[model samples]
Target: MFSLPQRLAAEALGTGLLVATVVGSGIMASSLTQDTALALLGNTLPTGAILVVLITILAPISGAHFNPAVSLVFAFRRELSAQEAIMYALAQIVGGIVGTIAAHVMFALPLLDASTKIRTGGAQWFAEWVATFGLVFTILAALRFARASVPWLVGLYITAAYWFTASTSFANPAVAIARAFTNTFAGIRPADLPGFIAAQLLGALCALAFAGWLLREQSDATQPLNAEAKP
Candidate 1:
């Protein structure tokens, strides 16, 4: 029973730390290695590990929705008011940028540089959609059946999505927007933001729709009986 302001604060703090981990790790990984695969592996693990830590600590306050897509999903599900969702998104976006700046400061890079990395195409767009869809679905399903396991579930899903998805699974709109501010290995070009955000939102909505139907609890009459159950 946290207040709205408290929840918003938690969201901001959690998102900030998440982005710091992402951008910082990316900068470090690239500096350490020339191998693309190894660099990606370096970027992937910290992001996933931080998700688990942030969600575990902050979920009680703000549902640990560090992603605009995740906040939007909760709004659609009627868990959060539309205004709350919007505020949460604003906090997350702002926090993410601040985190990026912090990462840059730590590495002595420019505080706010637009990314030059070119990351846009139909394949990547579709991959963003798939990545976000999987993320939201994992959250929804885990909440329904194993509420306590949501942290690990989401962390692991994003870790795997990073490897399997062509886009490295930016899956989070706030994160995607923040990453656009950095010119590091984790960054995406500012011009590519729109497509990624659009795909993420659409994927989240689709997951909401799919999970709604799939997670509905069946009545006893609708449940299938085991073959060994005697009449």
Candidate 2:
């Protein structure tokens, strides 16, 4: 229903707001509490809530794909042109970075500080893979079976995944990259990015393949040729 440029703008705006919510909430939560679990809960809720809000409002415009991994999955399915997918990714990445800066400005912190927070190791990478895999699966399956519930499905999944996953579920590459620029409760070190991103991409692709198999419909050739004519 929206034009390409308008869709791109929606993507940039949605991703920017999503990242801002993530970083801002993390900063607020950490500042409010020294308890790690409590802080994480604070961060998790806002991220999930924002996803639901953003997706509901912006899905018609740009499919509300705030993550590059999600965008790539759509591109692979041929639901979006490869060139449009690339443009969406670029907008998301740029918007995410701007989001970090927005968060920092709100908190009176320095803009664009490289994160010192370290998040690395096999466990973290595996957690990211699992996290992203679940996310993509949820989206595809919901789109197939319960299209109206996608926003809630995704929101609830991330809310739960945040606590279950060891990495607190940095499932989105754009969000991860944005987090790398903040020295906050939600930040991951820049050096650790490659592994997380790689794991996320692999996980997303696997979900696409699995969903293709699992959600596929039986061929119409199996039905009698006169079935439609009878109706």
| lDDT agreement with native, every candidate | 0.96, 0.95
| lDDT tens readout by residue for model 1, 1-231 | 999999999999999999999999999999999999999999999999999999999999899999999999999989999999999999999999999999999999999999999999999999999999999999999998999999999999999999999999999999999999999999999999999999999999999999999999889998888989888
For model 1 the local lDDT of residue 154 reads: 95
Q: Estimate each model's TM-score.
A: 0.95, 0.94
Q: Candidate 1: where is the Cα deviation over 4 Å?
A: 221-231
Count of backbone clashes, every candidate in sequence? 0, 0
**Per-residue lDDT for 103 in model 1?**
98
How does candidate 2 fare on TM-score? 0.94
Minimum summed lDDT over a 10-residue window in model 2 is located at 222-231
| Predicted structure 1: lDDT | 0.96
Q: Model 1: which residue pairs collide?
A: none
- Candidate that would win on TM-score: 1
Off by over 4 Å in 2: 220-231
TM-score of 1: 0.95
Best by lDDT: 1
